[model samples]
Target chain A: MPNNALLLDGTKVAESIKETLKERIQALGEKGIVPCLATVLVGSDPSSATYVRMKGNACRRLGIGSRRVVLPENTTTEELVETIRELNEDPAVHGILLQHPVPASIDEREAFEAISIEKDVDGVTTLGYARTAFGLADFPSCTPAAILAIMKHYRIEAEGKHAVVIGRSPILGKPVSAMLLNENATVTTCHSRTRGLPDLVRLADIVVAAVGRPRFVQGDWLKPGAVVLDAGYNPGNVGDVDYEACLGKASAITPVPAGVGPVTIATLLKHTVEAAEKYGNR
Target chain B: MPNNALLLDGTKVAESIKETLKERIQALGEKGIVPCLATVLVGSDPSSATYVRMKGNACRRLGIGSRRVVLPENTTTEELVETIRELNEDPAVHGILLQHPVPASIDEREAFEAISIEKDVDGVTTLGYARTAFGLADFPSCTPAAILAIMKHYRIEAEGKHAVVIGRSPILGKPVSAMLLNENATVTTCHSRTRGLPDLVRLADIVVAAVGRPRFVQGDWLKPGAVVLDAGYNPGNVGDVDYEACLGKASAITPVPAGVGPVTIATLLKHTVEAAEKYGNR
Candidate 1:
């Protein structure tokens, strides 16, 4: 068997993006326009906490500023909304990110919508969702935007290509499908409710595994020479795809730890800089 | 060559649905609950006028009442919104249908959002869109809902099925994909920008053509025994799928003139009845 699994170097690509963004950030700083991110956490969820910290750390390395607002676990929706509104009015806050899987009590949608679209670097607002779905030139959700950026960097031709996305979460599946369609790629979305998983996988030229199930897509089911983007971030650093099985089948494949993960933060930083430029001009 | 074009009898199915709805209307009338639809036409476009007239005639035949509101082509967005607001507040109007593709001056989304979720019989409101996309058991866009109803009537199994939906229009592509996902079918959405249309079509066990292009899907691309649903209503009464080419390949296919057309009106009536029931209780 040919060593078909060409490793998709996401880390290297992300570094390049960060380098470009750094220059942009330096130029903005020279003009006295500081790009900043306001990360709001409404609980002590370990994963959410870590993710927020990583984002803050990334901002520091990029010469960007970040404001951390940690709320109690029992924070009400109203309180969360108030905090977001405050951030929306803050001149220094260029982008706002309310950590995902917020406390069960808070209506996450309502809170997300409260973020002014101008400051929504994470693209979690209703306006952001509408713009992205409608194919308007606007900020897209960071992860989905990162996926597109990654594809573009690798010169992966998406137009007319069969892209089977294995997840339907609002942030991932639906939005990404919309973005892919905007890029002229034929996009298919599958979820836990979907049937005949392997058959669909076998027909795809590109497979984006995002259902969060580790080793869900086996190697044998992959179409030979297919590019694989594993977006699943499970415990123990396992991807939704069985990378071991994909070794000799995939033409190009993203590794679980260093693949889509690094690019998401890079895109988030890029969006922050963009938000600052637009808002600073105003 | 076997005339493989198995006519998917949409008119017959719609007739059956109408008959069932007629009985329901009679039962509701006996209880002093009459289904009423409010039709709002913003302009004098011939196609819009004809559609509104057809809906009104359908209402009359079913003993469902309708209120027609005609506005000039130059009506301002605020003026149109006010009219819809009045209709939304009317207790006598059980359902609201605003003929779409309103004049360019009118902000269509703003007007659609004005309709109360309960009174949005056409299922174009944000609530309706969100509910449908999130797989909430709510009213769907009439045409897409009719497609699902037809599939159910035929006892077509969609679970784990590979369904390729061509077109990504908001009312059709996005919501239909979500509905199919809810039914456990893996759905791929292709649009004008999609690459490799023929290859994608061949992988589908179920094909839905909603891209307004007339007869774009060729017969040779279909998998043998695939269930084809043609939802395109283009000029000259043409459908998106090429019925002539698909005859022998598809196990079932909806015809252009009668297939999805009548079912759409029938489903709208059903929503009217549902609106009346819910309104009466309130």
Candidate 2:
């Protein structure tokens, strides 16, 4: 939709990453290690089911084993915790992802706490979030990890650059801000509560749109030569940024359908392989 | 040292806080709550010794209990960890503070990790840092807490404001940035590694100087009517801001010596009282 904009090819990058994951998974298999990811679906949310299926397909293509554990729609908090505990103790399961936005009655934090830090490949556990935020040694959330991978793939050095992240969600914006800070970039996180959002966006050398509002960031808010990473995938194949307006204004920008989305699954597979390598050794 | 600059009245603020602490400590004592602070000093640095002494004197005047544990110059890492562990287990000690920048041979991170979260009144523990950074409910670091307290005292609402923090240290810059963000202010943290620092400062509604450089922020860098919180207490009683140049430019500014310094100690005392209330109940 955008003209003269260097499209960030997440599909191409993700494919290359899958190729690498395939080799890693194969090597693990040769060593009698099966890289396995356990997806725990508490309720039958259609979108979550679709996401889990996509992850499972990606795992199958990479020769990584995946276990899908679907619970009833009316599962209790204690039951979910017990299920997560079982996965944590399962030697065959290397990493675990409990689909987010579970039933309101379920204590999601308590459920996430049930997953052992070693098996928390989804990076939703308190330990994972803490380590990621503190820039300590640990696995990051898959989406944030995907963003990092994209940055690394493009050789977009964050050091000494101004990175403006338009969101402050636990899994995406906050973690990404910490990651960018760790890379020595002067990071600023803007959210709905933020004042003068457009002014902040216009000053960024790198703009990350993760606010989940479709086309919230306009082309006029972008700084020329800024690298734009659209992490928001709203309904109707819309992104948080106006891609068409950002054309020629941004030096590089990720497209809605193919950008960021494919990489999310690829990074999940990479984490699975890593988890297997570490846990399988034990 | 600069001429005709806006003076941050740190001395006056510190005096005011000291008076309040005196009253609070007396009232707590009347209610049989003896607030105790444990200062674990490692490898006696002269400046650190003086600071510890100041805290001890403040505690004495406020009727708060103070314990000074002085370690040998050649103390080992294991010895310091063991010392902190003992203090953490001590029921009588409400707060534990290991004077920062311990000997080059000793690992400060290990020492900080040894203190229990409940007893971490100075809020330097990994748990404290992580909770504050992630916007999770927890005690903030002393300086950041003091900054928030000062803002509250002045009735300066941070919500929907642009806060520029000119530093990025884990204890000061990063923590304060996180606190400002938690208060719903759009926070931008600048450091020696940051580019376009002056431009960022000019856009801030609130400017926090914590870079420890004397008069680093020029008057021209400030926006008119911006609230300036000078956390920089440089040698010779100078601040990071060009106080003279900002005299008429700022809506309100904290003066050096009395601005953030006194509030920091007061906040430390406040946490000490809280720790006592929590741990004492336990």
Candidate 3:
């Protein structure tokens, strides 16, 4: 471990969040509404299967209900949308998570949008994304929202600070930057097309690496006292930030296994419970 | 005029767009589909009234249809939502533009959301904003989309460029930054809470001022050869950029009167016409 460098232990933070969620789940159970998350998987891709299992396991651990809808690889866009429409109509289903990269033949965006805005606890719909970008979202994308939660738990100040975000994906890069802007932080968004990426990274007070490239961000690129959050989960369990090199430089850094990944699922579970409560109230 | 600064002439560009739109409008007219834009004004505010009339004149000039829905200042949110719902369902009305700042008591977001996403020609709804931010919008917020039009007409390169956007409003600043990001520019978003704003500005290749403060961005803060787009239309017709001081420094700059403002209305008209064509097809 690098001297004077604080580790942002996401696993611990996520556990705390899950503990609070357990209490909420218990209260929800007393009221006769069990929060349900429906996971729709189109194909049996290994990684996708793993993610679905993880989410289902998390729900079970927290006493929330989870259902998996498995479809064949040849599912058409209309067929997939029909599946989601049924999930939307089910009163017991509070949230829907359509596992992404759903077969090359299917229109992913269309299926994501088919989930009712009220049941969009996964925050993938265009309406949800817009509200998230505009700071009006009750539940935002899990990974980005989890990043915010980690920052909050650590008491990291976003106001008047410069945060450099390396990615522009709809779920992570884009929404997280907007969230930082909502917190009064000066935000710079860089992608593969961005020029002089290192120069941009070097000036940031907070750096978020979400480009999905294995160790893409060099340690030397980090500013001396910068807070670093790595959201990339590339192969070999590596993160976007080069952990060893940046270990000595950063003020705080998140480890790959215990970092953004765990918090994401926790946030998803938390939002699903919240959605159930709202649905129950209605 | 300041020396060595190329004026980004919005009047000329907007005229070009309107001229193109006129032919499209004529084609739609030939098909028995008159492009119609409905402007809903909540009160008798002079500025809002002026905007409504200007839109009507633009529609008339291009052989499109225009209707003004003027509601009393005391209209409740429910009443405004009901009025928008009516306009949304009206087959003849192709686009809806609810003039903003309806009333303090009226929930502006609720009113904006009430406009059907299909007829959100003004691009104020959450769905429209999200589509725009995600680079999938048919009609984005007029002002930000116009900013892109200006850049495209001038051939200002955005790919791999550093663009500092000085504001975070939903309409102008936020959307413009997202637009730049879509074009592959490294984008930095600043606002009232930004620290050492001048230092950030000096490093930018493109500077966009949408902070709504007169001359908030100083001339000396801009780097030499930077392209400047000022979106601020403050009282006395001054812009966010200190136009006089930056005129000699920037490679290009827009004048307040003929800059972003004129192009905004033109873009709105163009989108309204496009929305009409889509509605006609349906």
Candidate 4:
């Protein structure tokens, strides 16, 4: 075991970020402003419901208001968009998050597009994504932002690093690749259609596994001393990269449960706080 | 000499696309609709003026109306955006093209965002860029579309190929990377900040050089049998790739004069006709 591998503790980083946000939240309270996040879930997918509940609970812990808007599985796109627009107009809502994988019958993108850009703290809208790609976003998607937060906390330099991202998801893989590129990393975006994935992974200075499979990336796939960020959320707390297998090769690695997941929720609360600060300034 | 490299002739590909658009333009003509592209120029830069003239000539050849709105070099961003808004609301203008690199004092992106999404044939707006990234744009930026048009013309499959895009500019390099990823090509984006540029290029099955430097990419940088698309338009009709040096290594390559340039203008015309057809259908 090359037990020299440094564990990138995402929970510690999240705690540090939340510590700063806590002071800011209290400052906002003195000014009679309460940072708030409104979460909308269309279907009763148990996992999604739990995710939303977790996020709301996090916001409450930070002294931010939480509003839950649960809709039936049969909710039409029009109705969902209407609900989002009302939230957009609501002065009390600093941030809005619509749970992903809305029912198949709904036009999820249309509903996402309907969220006002100012209140889109979750960064689900197309405009926010573009802003992030252009390096001008105030609030990027929470998960990608969390990844960056982890890197920043660890002082990981991206300049001149060849980072291979093993996914092309709009919010996760794509956004993180763009952010890494902005940070001056040579970014390679690969998806399931890519040929010889293992051979490609062997050349990475930084490997981001976001393929959403359990232990899909073996230790043999990684270059010696490479930094690995496993962004996948598979069942039973297993990450996309085999944590045990990669431990011998990766110079630093994030564990599944305490890794990207908690930082993601913390990043969401940070965005909400930032949005509220902007509103308070106004 | 290995002088048998097949030229990926952009001029011929552009001609075929124009041939298809001619019939569409004539059909619109029958309906008393002239597909008009209103171009806005914010300054008197000589190159910008020449580009506007060239685009207008191309439109004239295709029986499309070209409207020029030239502002003084000292025009403010608000003035530029207002001009774009007027063109956006004009019923006669089916498409709008805003020549880029507006004066440094201007908020170019803000002005671009002012153009209505419907009339933004040039696809310079943030929303348009996001759509392009997501593979859902009605009209993507012309130069990137031009590169794809050339590839589709040659029937070179992007699936499973490793494509290295040597630029990260918003309208060109970045957009093309997204488009290639959408086509299932593993895309690596590199810029001036990238280390080992030549090594990265050598691994690519398809290399797109948009670095804007004259003859910056040498033949030694390419793998034998690689497809090279020189998107850089430098002074004196030179391209980003060293044509003579690359000829022996490239199995297929685009020449500067008849390469990506002609195809780009043709794509602008195609987008205009498409926009007009949409309005005509209404």
Clashing pairs in 1: A159-B195, A160-B195, A160-B196, A184-B193, A195-B160, B4-B247, B4-B248, B5-B247, B5-B248
- Deviation from native of the Cα of residue B60 in model 4, angstroms: 0.6
lDDT (Cα, 0-100) at A16 in candidate 4? 93
Interface RMSD, every prediction, one decimal place: 2.5, 1.6, 0.6, 0.5
Q: Which pairs clash in the backbone of model 3?
A: none
Residue A230's lDDT in candidate 4: 89
Chain B TM-score against the true chain B, candidate 4: 0.98
| After superposition, candidate 3 runs with Cα above 4 Å error | B1-3
What's the CA error at residue A118 for candidate 3, in Å? 1.9
Question: Residue by residue across B96-191, what tens digits does model 3's lDDT show?
Answer: 999977889899988998999889988888888899988899989988998999999899989999999999988788899999999999999999
Candidate 1 lDDT score at position A103 = 92
Rank by TM-score (best first):
4, 3, 2, 1
Instruction: Give the range where candidate 3 chain B is weakest over 10 consecutive residues by summed lDDT.
Output: B273-282
Task: Give the best candidate by DockQ.
Answer: 3
Off by over 4 Å in 2: A1-3, B1-33
What C-alpha lDDT do the candidate models reach, one value each? Answer: 0.86, 0.84, 0.91, 0.92
Q: Could you give me the TM-score of model 4 versus the true structure?
A: 0.98
**Tens digits of per-residue lDDT for model 4 on B88-189?**
778989998889889999998899889888888888888898999998899999999999999999998999999999999989999999999999999999
Error of 3 at A117 (Å): 1.7
